[model samples]
Target: MPQRIRKLIGTVLLLLLVVVWALSAMALAQGRVTELGWFLQLVCYVLLGALWIIPGGLLIRWMERPDQKV
Candidate 1:
């Protein structure tokens, strides 16, 4: 597939991923993280904040890939 197409798709997917991640994270925070002590809550928030980078990075890498030669 073309790089342009890959980027377009990846952009959409990345946005969707972020939305879903944020919603789920918020739910988790409201449900359980809020009940935890301050230090544990901080750790959970930090981990949840950074966890989305893994898939987002992969999608961005795919988006930036050189187009396959015919």
Candidate 2:
């Protein structure tokens, strides 16, 4: 596939990933994280906030990859 097309698809997927991740994180926070103590809650929030970066980074890498030569 062309790099431009790959990037366009990746961009849409990235947006969807972020939306889903945020919703899930919020659900978890509201349901379970709230029961934890303040420090643990903070830790959980921090981890959840940063966790999406892994997949997002991978997606971005794929999007930015040079097109394979024919």
In the range 1-70, model 1's lDDT, one tens digit per residue, is 9999999999999999999999999989999888899999999999999999999999999999998888
List the candidate 2 regions with Cα displacement exceeding 4 Å.
none
By TM-score, how accurate is candidate 1?
A: 0.97
lDDT of 2 by residue, 1-70 (tens): 8899999999999999999999999999999889899999999999999999999999999999999998
| TM-scores, one per candidate | 0.97, 0.97
Minimum summed lDDT over a 10-residue window in model 1 is located at: 26-35
